[model samples]
Target chain A: MTARAAMGVLLASLAGGAGYADELLPYRIEGNAVPVSLTGKPGDAARGRTIVTNRTLGLCLLCHSGPFPEERFQGNLAPDMRGAGTRWSTGELRLRMVDSHRLNPDTIMPAYYMIDGLNLVAPAFRGKPLLTAEQIEDVVAFLATLRD
Target chain B: MKRFHALMCAVVLAAVAGPAGSADIPLDQRRSGYADLGRDTKAMQDDDTSNPASLGVQDGEALWSQKAGTAGKACAECHGDAAASMKGVAARYPAFSPARKGPIDLEQRINLCRTENQKAEPLAFESRELLALTAYIGRQSRGMPIVQSDARLTSAIDAGRKLFTQRIGQISLSCAQCHDDNWGKQLASSLVPQGHPTGYPIYRLEWQSLGSLQRRLRNCMIGMRAEPYAYGAPESVELELYLMWRARGLTVETPGVRP
Candidate 1:
């Protein structure tokens, strides 16, 4: 392998591992809301719905009941997802999607976009948030559509 | 007037001693983890002959009288006929231990008995041998109410109660969130139980083997993405004690089969 090619390979591996996982874009929280978008683009509500209802990726249904009629089991830990959009503005939802702990310290909801202040996170998942910035926007968009 | 005064006094005492074990869930509504189990699993637990954990029970029976160690003593020799002597013993465990100067779970108690009386090495945690013995001893207390009210365990129990509500891990979930507040509600496809420690050496379908309450607690911590406490850690024993206290009036269902 050539030196230039080897450098390229190393860069690729770095991008795929901890280097990528640790890259969390700073977002401003303004009065219980993130007024700006993380991806600099509006999220796809349809894609957001998929993330919300997925068993593994999002696990939102693990604690919150929602309008997914096909999903047989829905959690009762948190408030229902119905009418969420009607309850809060898009910005407020965005802040919540990032870190609900800022809203309520006693909340059991995990910080989807935070890496600090967590206790004993598994080694494999260390420094990794439960959701990426784009994924958080997607979920926020889907939750916002629950206004009806 | 006299009758009303006596009734009011009784009410005041009852209020002072309300079922703090159940916390907020009414006494009648505090369902055991067994209730959340499937019908087939419940059936399996009910029938000792059919229960897979019964195998562990048999293993324990064999170990009871089998002499071992330098002293060459058997548990049965010291405490003969588990039916009589061991009855209700396991139910009150995670009790105060004079030797440890702290709380010790049933597994630790067995090890203590082995080392002190039999002059044997302590069995490893989560080992088949220890599970078997624990199952046997736990079975002896089957159907008996879990009783634990030692004054020495006050601080430890208080710590456990605090831990139960304290959030942990990246998920930042607490025991009270899932097992205490939202119990009987569905978490994905599984029904969350109140998490009473009525059964130890329980046979889980996922494991296809019997495991101790400590093992189960470790699994729960892992579920929260938190590092689990070491087998004989003080925190783990204290948590076990608090769980037993939470399940005070519940009947023991050792060697319980669950899916």
Candidate 2:
């Protein structure tokens, strides 16, 4: 088989594995409500906090400010997260994380989950999303706890 | 009398805010990454002996006088002394070229001179010889304000502006989002400066070597997860033209040190 075809087979096998079944989940957007059907168990808030601050993984601090006192030089391009839990519901936040463009077409925020219509994606990342569904749930779980 | 006082206050506020209002700072007020450089790097740029880019300039000087190709002509033979003839020449580059039927940067112009005039092989883009020669020529224009292109390049400039503002890549961030909109804001522990093309063929601390403006543009494209245009691509030239136009009054800091 060609190298590309072989690579495709490898990716297919990986996607077919037990844990990766939830990698591609489909959901409909109705107004501001976004229902998430996670195949994994409920997310851990601690894991979510780590993901939010990790530069290589989430890069959330690049444009959004949060209450992470240890991290200096947080970006101010987006809204600050002093009381994000009070501002948005879990479903609303999940929708924004999955595909913010659905809410505001002109938003500069990146869609962490939805993968369609992306341009010039790197070869290894072509068919993959930035974060898995479980990671998204974890982030949502953590964000939901940030009450004022 | 009260209404007049209010009007005067509004006028003063607008004048202080400039054209884009308070959110958009004027170009003159914005500092180049050069200003943000640490003392050691700043000192390196100030003195020729400490500056690494001076090495490229020295190589370029040798290449300038050396004769090559079937014509047996040196750059000095036609252009005369670079000090006198090349002074402020780099400031006017990416000029509209009728022969090329578009805007062409100094690198392309050099390649044209080599191939057409000297009957020599064109230097590869980003090659050692090209970077050195470009650095040499650009060094002559150091401290001079960048010159805006002639009216003929309006269409190309417009096209460049579109590319700058157009959203692309997986991140879906346009150049305007960071450079124009959020300049002075922090991103990943670094301050995002206005994306001006002032000191090109610059000696970047990151690259640890001299590189052209196109190389920097390509880096930004990769950072945004977008496909970068090929070197000497027309689109790249257009963007260069726009950037130079945007920084029309900014002084050239050739071989500038940047973090």
Candidate 3:
């Protein structure tokens, strides 16, 4: 798809707003299981990289250090992601992004997609998930390319 | 591959060499920010001359005596000698209030007194005069231990505890995640204190002024990407009650200096 079309799809996905209740998605945890794409298209790694580095969006660097040396002040709270691509498959990365609590009940990482069973969420964000499904796919795509 | 191996080794070594246990105190018996402050900031709090919050206390003292409203009564007129009357008062708040039928912090209590007792307009939360008066009143309790009671505030305290542990916002962090679980651990570049309410209205260099405890709470909520409650919201008061109870025996360090 053209860059403009990709941007249009991303904007449309995000415009779902915070009002609608989150629709649960079904996916298997088996190795290399690919969930159905909400955006109905491949993700752009450039956009994915932007989501991973943006503090307001991804905030991955707040806890997890990555290979982005240009970005100063990466956090040391969680494991570094220098070779994330080689460490985990894209499907595994997707599950972690969607709902990490399924894997580890005690993780401090936020679920970028799942919205059920939250507390004290702002009225504006009561039912909405943090990132759109396309954005999660974009981040997954970006993490898949982190192999050095 | 070599870099990855080195990184793994560093992680393993760090895990094996866990944080020292010598200075680690149980969560219930932690020290106040006064003890956690760096040397320079602690010195600033020790000396009135260098303490910026002292200026607010001075302003608050003036406001205490100034006549206001139709009644034209100063805070000193009814509650004469703040050094004595106000002493240890701050440490007992967010206490249960019969009138409000809920928990009320020192800030809200002051506002209630202004509107009901003094017949004056209630000061806006975080206003200069409000913070000044709060700092002044709180300063009187400087070394007094925080004395929150769960006797009449069990429900409110319980609610606050839930809020403390409940994850919210886009970032999905609860107060316990940083302040409870990782207190004293470095986040970004700063050490996370045990989320106590012992040193407010505190003098934060980041704020460059004295601010109410609610202001600090709102800042945390925003940082976690959660929508903050309104200044006088009961949820904020509930959270304050929980924090005060959590810091039960810690001495009040009003006009506290923090980085």
Candidate 4:
């Protein structure tokens, strides 16, 4: 199996061992724990890049320095993400990108998943998710490639 | 003629009572169904029940009594019993200080005292010691009038007034929009009070700690999606001065607890 496929199998086996019956469920069960779902294939670099720059997508550069050479007006709120793949394992990067707030309670970052604990000012927007499942997977794939 | 004096007294009383009664105006009128100034007032009026001092007050009291730094002078040495010496002190802050050549709010004054009187290091803004001492000193003036005034300070006051009125940030809502125009309106889960300065340096339950007027102002700016002024920045000082002026005559409620 490819590294990506191996990781997926490991995750699936872990989920099975943990008795999470909904491991392969297509539909998402969002709440305080399921912020966003993922369905992107590995190596989708072009789509990942699109998500990073898309204002409605990742918007990662808004608060961090990234290797997007053409982008300007980025904020220095978080650490530079130019070499994220070298700095963190795929699993660690996955967790951090998913919800950096969980690691540092005082961090200003938002959780991409586990949505139930958010503060929604307007009721019309309540219970609605932030990012879609495929978008998260694509973004992760893009982040995993930033080794050099 | 005697009735005129009584009428004047009533007016003065009404003016003094303005801040407390009107503090929660915005939340009541908004669509959120979140706030009620009347309830807040009722809770405030029953101070023994609602106004339990926060940890900041306790820390401040310790700092006030403790001798620190080179001068070997505790705040008690120069101020001589905070309850008596410091009473009404805060009510007069955000006033003109010729040395500063502009405005001197409570935070600046605290730093000044730390440097000049206590001969200690100036506490940084939002520092535990600073917040504590500020809370303690403010508690001394609880129930006194917020009485800032000056002619030379008009420029700063004007700047502050503009800030209060001007809308900034992504939300495009000015302080006046909620506090003045649509007070008693609901936002979400909370009430937007009339933007009174009465219960300042209050311990907000949401914050889980005591915070100064500047802290509250920053939070509001963030809510408006506006860039926050740095702590101790001139804009924040100007804004605070204006708030003090707007909230004049209202009794101070330092070390106050709020939701």
Candidate 5:
């Protein structure tokens, strides 16, 4: 493809993909607002791992240590997540992933489904949550299965 | 841009010009407080670096010296000798790049070199390669002054300064709160410095490898319970520039051993 054409294609792709993901995970963010969805299937640990490792899914291993078939991909920044289930209760894990500040207040973790509202952000994220209710539940289910 | 400027104007107006007496601590204790904090920080620096984490630094050194990629430009080619070549490089970064026309920290600069010069894919922020490269690069300026400055950096400096003072994390602790308001305060076992940018690209004993300024900022954001700026994003660059300015007088300690 010509350079100009490629540039056009890239721009078009970006424009098209801009907020489409939100269609499936409809949510918003307003300054410091938290997004919590009390909904979804409790994910199977095995299935959750697939999503966690999936490049388009949770992508948790990007900054977290975890036991997975993909050993080469684990990050060393945090403690190994292999035995997380042994340490944290399911409720604790859910809260930590969903919005860690509720627990530690000083944690650097993002509000998965919650939007730590940015009043100056945009109208779309002004008062909405970040993760859709369903994605939060899916991620929660996945986190629950991190035993061993 | 206008709104952001307006926000900045308000912030600058609200800034307490000079250091104020500590509201929480006793008056006399506040005087020697910073000095005592320094001692505590030095103590925390005594990490057991003789472990797996230290191994990452060795790998980074190897990677820094290795000549791979299509252009055959190992970092050594342009950077020259790692030990002598990178002196004071890390501290001056998050500064404006004439070529890129924006502020870029050392990690992004390295990635730009890799992708454009080496013809390689950019490493992810948390990747081992990025960590190793950061460590090796930092090692080059172990004892130099951070000394970041440029006339073209006014706007970036302003933006970064705003970011440093703005409280965004769920914990509501701005960079200023810890590094400015309580530079010598103890947060658990750790003593907070003025958030100096010295010894960057240094081998952090905790991660057991070298990390870039952006990585450190991201970690700080996590520590503050804030959403991290994405790797290589403009916000991160702006923040980096501000940090460089904040640590202006500190010497560069790139690739230094840290606990």
Candidate 6:
């Protein structure tokens, strides 16, 4: 295995001796999308909405303004989240959620799924993804519901 | 009000990232992080009596006169009244150090005096003594404009500017992204400031104690999930040089209280 892969295994072992840390399952980026549901089925959009609005959980509104009228405040850094589903396919959104760095290396969007190549990760979040795969699906499902 | 600041961040980032150190901005556009604070916090910084950091300054005043090291010499012996001697000292760092052949921040310069001048062991970074001393000295420069005084180290400044704009960590964001690009905007519940290096060692609400500029920088590095430089590291000094240069003309507000 590559040095990078070995390091991942080490971190996984550190998590617990199961060779699975946060259980970041394999997912392929076909072109610009994952092309398959991370949980093998679409997630609950209602649950996804809760995650999106949560400051600690999704933190999406911290950088992207959306149609959440009740939020009272939202960020203006990245593109607006309005009409997100109308713009990108569900798989495309999933890939972006997983890691937008592949599309724009300098993008400030955090990779919610991938854990390798990160630095100074706080001990509490050392072996964890920003969002679990289940949470990623929920967010993806919520984003898929956005329309003009 | 540089209303175009939102658009200018990308332009600024592009410029700062490409050239050696092109973090330069028009004088009209530079806004101190103070501009983003709530009224209560600003009021606290304005009032010496009410400011919690005033306590640290009091400790620093005592430290200045107290003798230390084998020589048992006090800072007052050589520097005289801090009010007069240190008036513009903090405002002019991280200045180029002629002896060291690079830039040195106020904190490092203070430690340097301890080890080299007083024959005392240098104070640890962020130690109460260091913070108190720095807080006291920084208070002398309050309301004085931040001035750049470098004989050389333009290369170091360039390196710092590059570091400011270079993307890092799991988040893949640079300093310029949130600070330069998105200052004046809300992130979660807090307002993003322009990331100026004025008025430190500041009394941060999160830390609940006086802390140096390096401490604040480390906080951001950790928040960004990027590896932070060691205290007084070359990278930290260079970043300080660049930030001081960028903050030129902003008034010092030492022992600043912030949420």
Q: Model 4 over residues A43-135: C-alpha lDDT tens digits? A: 376788887876444656655667777776655545778898787765566556566655765444545543345432233223333344456
Most DockQ-accurate candidate: 1
Measured against the native two-chain assembly using Cα atoms, what DockQ does each of the candidate structures obtain, in the order listed? 0.50, 0.43, 0.30, 0.02, 0.03, 0.39
lDDT of 6 by residue, B1-259 (tens): 3556545544434444444322445669988878878899899889989899999999999999999998899999999999999999999888778898888888888988999888999999999999999999999999899986343665777788877877666565778878776777777667888888888999998888888899999988877767788999998998888888778789998988888
TM-score (chain B) for candidate 5 is 0.73
True-vs-predicted CA distance for residue B139, candidate 3, Å: 0.3
Clashes of 6: 0
Quote model 2's TM-score. 0.85
Q: Candidate 2 vs candidate 4: which has greater TM-score?
A: 2
RMSD of each: 5.5, 7.4, 11.2, 17.2, 13.7, 6.7
Q: Write candidate 5's Cα lDDT for B116-179 as tens digits.
A: 8899888888688887777666666655655654646666776777777665643445676666
In terms of TM-score, the best-performing candidate is 1
Screening candidate 3 with a backbone cut-off below 3 angstroms (N, C-alpha, C), the clashing residue pairs are none
* The 10-residue segment with the lowest total lDDT in model 1 chain B: B13-22
lDDT of 1 by residue, B1-259 (tens): 7777566545533433423332545657776778877788899999989999999999999999999788999999989999999999999999888877889988999998999889999999999899999999999999998886565676777678777877777687888878877787777777888888888889988898999888899888988888888899998888988788777778999988766
Q: How do the residues A55-105 of candidate 1 rate in per-residue lDDT, one tens digit apiece?
A: 777888988888999998888777899999999999999988899989987
Query: For model 2, what is the alpha-carbon lDDT of residue B57?
Result: 94
Off by over 4 Å in 4: A1-148, B1-52
Judge candidate 6 at residue A49 and give its lDDT. Answer: 94
DockQ of 2: 0.43
| Candidate 4 lDDT by residue in tens digits, B13-54 | 344332322232332232211224347744753464455455
Judge candidate 2 at residue B219 and give its lDDT: 92
Chain A of model 3 scored by TM-score:
0.79
Poorly placed runs, candidate 5 (over 4 Å) = A1-148, B1-54, B188-190, B202-210, B256-259
Candidate 6 chain B: worst 10 consecutive residues by lDDT?
B13-22
Ranking of all predicted structures according to lDDT, beginning with the best and ending with the worst: 1, 6, 2, 3, 4, 5
| TM-score, B chain alone, candidates in order | 0.90, 0.89, 0.88, 0.80, 0.73, 0.90
